[model samples]
Target: MSERRRQFDRDGFLVLPGFASPEACAGLVAAAERIVAETDVDALETIFDAKGQGHGRDRWFLDSGPEVRAFLEDTPEGPKRVNKLGHALHDRVPEFRAFSDDPRLDALVRELGVAAPRLLQSMLIFKYPRVGGEVPAHQDASYLYTEPVSVIGLWFALEEATLENGCLEALPGSHRLGLRSRYRRDGDRAFTERLDPRPWPRAGWRPLPVPAGTLVVLHGLLAHRSAANRSPDPRRAYALHVIDAETEYAADNWLQRPADMPLRGFSTPA
Candidate 1:
């Protein structure tokens, strides 16, 4: 195995500083903002309120809007925000689609021994200031289960991710523990159960703070989670999940949508 792959294998995750250029990251953020501004309330209701229902191509999925609104103070403020906007931006939005098809990411996945890695899911997680929800420690395989559990996450920071703003925290080498039972979910739109019965050493958890444009590659079985944003600034990031094309993606996976398609390979970036 290559040195980089070895490092990831040992740590269950790898942080690549400045993986995306500043200009690229800015463009992505702008695209997300535009999606929110242009999306109508009807669309938002359909995406956020309707559980397990799939919106047509290139639509924003606003699963967390109601919760965010409920948590908002009564003062007149900006409109409510959702926890994420995705699962299909890669296939629909030009900028996101371009980023998804970026050859450098595919090359890295290939280097990690994932021959023909296919894109499984894409999400732009919004950790809104103060009201951002905490994600419980869990494994990606719990949601993206495959025969050998080939799913891997490429999480890119679109803005500075700091501990005060809920940066990702992971337990190094935790992937060795193998798959654990998944957190129960009411529907595709609800918060995942935060508590897992399995005991984890709290001391081993490490917070990873990365600047905009950095990429964090994670193993599917790695135990990781992020806290709620307590700071006044928002924490925004893009996460793309991919799996080996050779594996069978079970139909029962929680993220399944009718728009789902086969993962495609991209050429290396210049």
Candidate 2:
């Protein structure tokens, strides 16, 4: 195995600086900005609960505008921003579609020894100033569970991710501890469960600050979380997750949406 792959297996995550060129990253940012500006929040599918289920767009907005607005927050100087634009972008946005199909990502996943890697989901995360919510420590497998737990996340930094702006922090070697149960949600947004009972020591968790265009690859079972952004600048990112196509996707996984196209160069199983 290559050194990078070995490092990933040991650390539960890998950070590659400048994984995407400046121009490429700029293009993605432009696309994201345009989509955010054009999208009618009321017309988009709403994920109102922690279980990741909600009434589809039509019903959520027209039928329950006041309740939904109560759950959302507006910025003092700018328009309200959703925490993330979910998997639907792979089909609706051209830039995201291209990024998801990038051959470089395929090569990296191949090095991880996953066979026939398939694109599981894509998200454009808007960690906007002040209002960007805190994500609790958790494993991706809890939501995107597979029988053998083969999910891998590729998080690309579109802007400077800093300690002041709520960059991702992770517990090294935590993936080796195996998957944990999902956190119980208290409301439309907050997590109620505590991480004190986990096997790893929280004191050893480290902050991972990456410059724009960097890529952070995460193991499915890795325990990771990010703080709420309190800085004046926004910390934006694009996260694409892939799974080994040969593995069986669990029926009970919270994210039951249909899988997007497999990454290029990986064979689709018959």
Candidate 3:
């Protein structure tokens, strides 16, 4: 069996404890906090309120907020404020890039059997105390499209993720069964079409129990969702999507990438 098969079988999810360190998490937290703090130099636009926490009369229900957008504040012109801290924190850092394309990261993907990996997208997710974000039951591929159904998602914990803080909960091994067709006005085509909703057999359903600093690599088809931050503390996770390198992007815009992108030979970016 492959390393991924073993890990997924044993723990339902693979937790590379300490994949990220406390110190590293601290810096990121501070940087993100600065962005939340409204300031003159850093005026943000929309905060993309995932929970609709501070929505006003004008706020609308978006399927999903911008992958990267400005952080909002309490003022009337709040939503217009760019996510100053978020943008600055990630944009100015070399580590984020390094981590995203890290050879070790690629190796983990290889270990998972994703022959060649393609860097798709990356984003930082933060769930604050009692912020309980609502995530409908569905596998990621139900929302994202990638070839071969072998896209590996690397979620790096930036804080001590606990049940209270609402860590990412996933049903592992579900990828083997293939994608589930789901429907959402704002859902990804990968799962937009309605198929069998039942995650049958109960043999492949594995819910993850991950800790802070750990890297959990999961197949995109694996069913997963972020739990609500029910505790007084906050939970932060940075996720990056890497697909089998033979993967292709055949679209003009991001919302839609062509299902068929040309494939390349076996090679590592490292």
Candidate 4:
């Protein structure tokens, strides 16, 4: 087994500093900035608060499985700020597509035992300067669930992620804690159903402040969270969630796509 796989198995997450080039990170940041600049905030009313009630069940949030869509948020600074551009940024944006299709990702997943990995979801998360909200500690499997829990997250830092700018903090070996809840859709409504009542640890989370172009690989069931950005600079990141193609994706999982929009693997051309 590769060293990275061994480390991930032990820690539930891996930080690969400088995994991406400086130029690549800059390109992604520029693309996301352009999208935000062009967006009409006044028309976008639904907010994307991860800690909100029902986890945002509106049509604008629920129906963004196949296309690129933007979600706004009301921060300490103000309302209507772009919270994230998600679901299919990699599939729709040329600049994002190029970065998402990097061959190194293919080899990395294979080494980690993710055979026939499929790209399940993508998002550019924005931690707006002095306004980004706190992301509650949670497991990724609760959202993008699979039969055997095959989901994994590749979070790339497009800018410096520091303590002041809300870098990621993770509980080592927390994947073994098992899934705590499921974010499900029933009819048109969405809700989180508790599967385990065990409380997350109050301490022991290790902060992962990293430089630009760093990649943080997270296990599906890992417990991770980030604080509100209080610095002058914004913290930008591109997150890709992948799952083993062989696993059975739960039908009730909140994010769903039409049959025509089949999931693509790293080996498949964009």
Best by lDDT: 4
Q: How many residue pairs clash in each candidate at the backbone level?
A: 0, 0, 16, 0
- Which order, best to worst by lDDT? 4, 1, 2, 3
Q: How much is 80 displaced in model 3, in angstroms?
A: 12
lDDT of 3 at 97: 49
Provide the overall lDDT of each model, using Cα atoms, as 2-decimal numbers.
0.73, 0.70, 0.53, 0.89
Model 4 RMSD in angstroms: 1.2
User: Top TM-score: which candidate number?
Assistant: 4
Task: Give the alpha carbon lDDT tens digit for every residue of 1-270 in model 3.
Answer: 786668765444577787767876676566555544545434333444433323222122121122233344223532233222232122234555444545677677777777766555555676656653544455655434555455666778887777667776766566666667632332322114557766445454444556677888766777666666678976767776666756553232123323352222223232
Off by over 4 Å in 4: 53-55, 76-79
Candidate 1: tens digits of C-alpha lDDT, residues 243-267: 8978887665555545434455553
What candidate 1 gets wrong by more than 4 Å, as runs, is 41-79, 183-196, 257-260, 267-270
Instruction: Give me candidate 1's TM-score against the actual structure.
Output: 0.80
Q: Report the Cα lDDT for residue 265, model 4.
A: 83
Q: Model 4, range 89-203, lDDT digits (tens) per residue? A: 8788889888998889988887887888888899999989977778889999999999999999999999999999999999999998899999998878788899998889998
- Tens digits of per-residue lDDT for model 2, 112-226: 8678787766777777888776766778876666779898999999998999898999999999886667433232332323344555565889999999989999999998888
